[model samples]
Target: MDAVRPLPDFLVKRYQGWKATTYADNRGWYKRLAEEGQRPRAMVISCCDSRVHVTSIFGADQGEFFIHRNIANLVPPYEPDGDHHGTSAAIEYAVTSLRVGHLIVLGHSGCGGVEGCYQMCEGRAPHLEEKTSFVGRWMDILRPGYERLAAGNEADRMRALEKASVMVSLENLLTFPFVTKAVEDGLLTLHGLWTHIGEGGLETYDPAAGGFVAV
Candidate 1:
């Protein structure tokens, strides 16, 4: 694999400038927050795409959200298999430890991870062996959704696959004991959300309606 280098010169210099400006604008607020620790109301699981930044998308400031990211914004089915359960550990901390009031699984259109699922379903990506591709394993949770949504036109099928993927992930969330307990006790709620990156629209999943509606 090729070694990744630092950010481009322009981005590095621009971020340096922004850092100083932010410090000047919120020095006192930052210090107070650092001392007090965080009490964010929500936890968000989103994609690791460079274009999909949680704080910027929500206009959140420091200490607003406890966020986690994975390919395709997926949450694996609860399996305490090994030491490298990064996403699971984050979910445990955010829900059980932090006691966040809401946990949102944020999925988006034009997601590369979701697209990868499409390729796998069609047998297009030969390099994706079941054991090696973490993407393959993580995304397997969405396979049933893809199968159910397989009847429509190519465009419609993609849309269905994307939306169904979110629903499947929501189901996976309930498999986690802490998340299930939180829901049962009425202390926490889970939501599935879809974002239209191209047009900047937010559609939330509605189980009763069986669709994504504007929220």
Candidate 2:
């Protein structure tokens, strides 16, 4: 393959600097992680939004978490019909192979994917409704959430759907036989989280409360 263009200088420079500084300071830890392999205690499924910083907020070191990110941070119902599923594959490996004790589905305020789904379900984004729209197809998993949360004004509904998206993923995760078995055997637990970007706040889902409360 030929170069489309030279890589951005700033990104390259930043990586080089971080490699020399942070990695240098943690060389021994990095070497130990590489030799022993990653044994993360938890697996986090979050959105692809650049603003969402899972590691910085958790203050986690390298190899502490098995993280998977996709738009809207969704997980679809399990289907073994010989189809390609990236999120499912990651979850399978994390639960069955890695044996992670906790599985966290992290949603965020002002999620573009959630907003898109809201627009899409309301017949606003025809382009997203098209079959070829990868994001639209992926967000179909969140349609159930929007349907259940169609109350209130647009802004409130969108926010409700954002949290609903996390709930939906947490539910779908249990649809996997392996995941169910792990949870039933007390080998795994499920959690849902929603973050407020500008407010720098996080909230945990309490199944009993049936609503989000600050954390």
Candidate 3:
């Protein structure tokens, strides 16, 4: 294997600074966490976009949330076909093992993964249509959402698709037997959230209103 290089100077400096301040300030809390293990109240499935800061958005402290990030913040339909499933495994662990009270799917504006899914569905992105493309296959989960989207202008359509991604994930979460059991047993609740990246606006899906409303 190739020899590993040292961390970037800026990152190393930032880590040292944090260690001197944040870690030092919370040393006892950190030690307790290490000994007790995590017991987060919620599991958040969020996009892997760097701009979508899940912990910062909620002002979550260390071990407050069990977060899983992936392309488009998606959850695929449960398939116990013996294939590797990273997202499914995380959900199972969060629900069945950690017994988190809430499962949240957090989608955000200007999501490149959602845009790619929209483009692929519209036949405007031939590259993403290739079977060999991992993103294309992964985003196939959102095709139903794309098909359900109403006709609109480009910008509006993209924004709608982003929210649809979150809704689709929420629906897919129910397909997991463990998730279904947890919900039915009143041990877990599911939530769908979307944020406007530029304005820092948050919205939650309201089934009664049949749309997202500002939170």
Best by TM-score: 3
lDDT minimum window of 10 residues, candidate 3: 1-10
Stretches off by above 4 angstroms in model 1 are: 1-8
How badly does each model clash, as a count of residue pairs? 0, 0, 0
Q: Each model's TM-score, in the order given? A: 0.91, 0.97, 0.98
Runs with alpha carbons beyond 4 Å of true place in candidate 2: 3-6
- Tens digit of per-residue lDDT, candidate 1, span 3-24: 8887899999988898789877
Candidate 3 local Cα displacement, residue 113, angstroms = 0.6
Error of 1 at 13 (Å): 1.9
lDDT of 3 by residue, 1-215 (tens): 47888899999999999999999999999999999999999999999999999999999999999999999999999999999999999999999999999999999999999999999988999999999999999999999999998988989989999999999999999899999999999999999999999999999999999989999
Against the reference, the lDDT scores of all candidates come to: 0.85, 0.95, 0.96
Worst 10 residues of 1 by lDDT: 125-134
lDDT of 2 by residue, 26-101 (tens): 9999999999999999999999999999999899989989999999999999998889999999999999999999
